[model samples]
Target: MSNETEPAPAAHGQPTLKAIADAVGVHVSTVSRALKRDPESPDASKSVRRIHRIAEQMGYRPNLMAAGLRTNRSYTIGVVMPRLTDVVIAQTCEAIEEAATAAGYQILLATPPDEVNAQLQSIQMLASRRIDGLIVSSIHLDRPDMVEEILRAGIPTIAVNRRADGKLHAVTTDDYHGGYLAGEHLVNLGHRRIGIVAGPRHASTAWDRTQGCIEAITSRGIEVDEELIVHTDFEVQGGISGAHRLLNLADPPTAIFAVNDTAAIGVAGAVRDRGLSIPRDISLVGYNDIPLVSQLPVPFTTISSPAAPMGSVALQQLLRGINEGEMSSLKLPVSLIVRASTTVPRQN
Candidate 1:
């Protein structure tokens, strides 16, 4: 006897339309047409449903690879963000995922290590995956080639947070308005000399917030001291260093507005290190109203960017583009939350 003991019976291959047609006692061509009946064809719903049920029972999986090769569409969206480590970015990613799932599509997320080169690589990766669309939330907006390549790939692209000067579609908050609100609020509280902790210079949000603050202060006839404005990374240490620079001035500001809450918390710590009580020696306001800001020992007065809403809107726009080639720019609203950290400057 052969050691193999007669090879086990070959497993049955997946059922095809021909096998289903034979079981249903119909022609293979009839089964094929019935399975994919045109809308104009008469009363094909029953047959189509029957075919679908049979296919399901047979554990049929569509050859999506073949279809994608033919149509050059993967029915997937590429989402590029800085990193999920940032709470706001993480929340936005969650919202995007929810929206994409609701629309019967999948999202592929990529975090670019750096602003310039990461954008280029992200675009290439999305293109390679044959993604139907892309939503990019960038730290900087200087990548012309990235946008151009996305356009060349013939995929709809939406920029989030960072806006480009060109005609690309984007979804972002009213950053200037948010900044203006923060400025006006501080000025209303009688904070005459205000300092600003700004994010990186290349980021449009940072520029908008800075300009809005300047405009608000100038409109009130208050001179915005150039030395009071310090550009730093959007991190805790950045805020700490910025606070030091501002407070060390011969005439320190009565209040400070940090670009984001993380930096604002740092400013708060710096103020305390100097044996100063918050809102007594110096009032502080922050942006982004991130969760931890409110839960801190002293709640921060801050502007709230609708991160979740922005993410949802971006996904909705991308889906529209994928389904119907629709495109539009969306600017979401932001609000200011007054908390314990800000108050009228105490007269010495």
Candidate 2:
């Protein structure tokens, strides 16, 4: 017999197949097969059950990277999400991560600028890592080149938050309906002259919301003042600039509907600078009832989009596409939240 002493497994390190096999008095191949088999299966062999018990005691975890090399499946998901600094985006990504983890997959995330070139680079990098699937959140409505490249890659893909001009499966909020709700609320409050802090037109989310708001206003026999609509970035500064432009108009609107809560905060600042107050000089409505909006001193009247659910549903759709060669688009519903920031327009 050889005189070599058995090596002890590390206390804080991952347990290897050899370690588990040795503990179970079996060969490494047997241990590998046992690990691959479902431990909870009612028909598992007695030997398999014993191996699993010992493996559990040793805290063994399969080497997915190593197995992927042989199986040709990385079992990893790639995510290209921009504006992660935004609360809504952050919440959505967190949900995606949670869902991916629960589904026995890991995510390789890239948070590049929302520009097409930058996003393309990120996608390329993720592809190099052999991602099994992809989720994109910043697809521009006016640009289809990057989306075409993604489709050509033949990897299962899903879009979230924004659609790819209907070129890809998407999980998004009903932004149009959300905008309509905001406009309808303001109009019901007797504010006929309304202004819109529309976001960039490149994003379908912004354009759809703008169109929906306009539809609500015009459907009520109110002529929308084209001059009242200001398209800008989706940031607070954009909101501030748009608000100033609308307020400077010859006939300023009595109500302002900002496409996002962050922008609405900026609009509020502009109102304060103009020595005006919300619902007094201008009734303010915003989309996306982020947690901070509800805590604001003048709580925002906003549309509550399902950010977390969108992420979760996107993951499910991508998995279906990856496994069953099936995919479909989804649009989660949104609701309007009445808060202190909105009320009947002040009597002139």
**lDDT: worst 10-residue window of model 1:** 2-11
Give the per-residue lDDT digits (tens) of candidate 2, residues 10-85: 4988888887888778899999888765454446698987887777667766678787888798989999999999
Quote model 1's TM-score.
0.79
Tens digits of lDDT, candidate 1, 146-216? 66766776778888876765567888899998889989999999999999998788787888888888788
Evaluate all candidate structures by whole-model CA lDDT and list the values in order. 0.80, 0.89
Scored by TM-score, the top model is 2
State, as a TM-score between 0 and 1, how close model 2 is to the true structure.
0.84
Best by lDDT: 2
Root-mean-square deviation of each candidate, in angstroms?
A: 9.7, 6.9
Model 1: colliding residue pairs = none
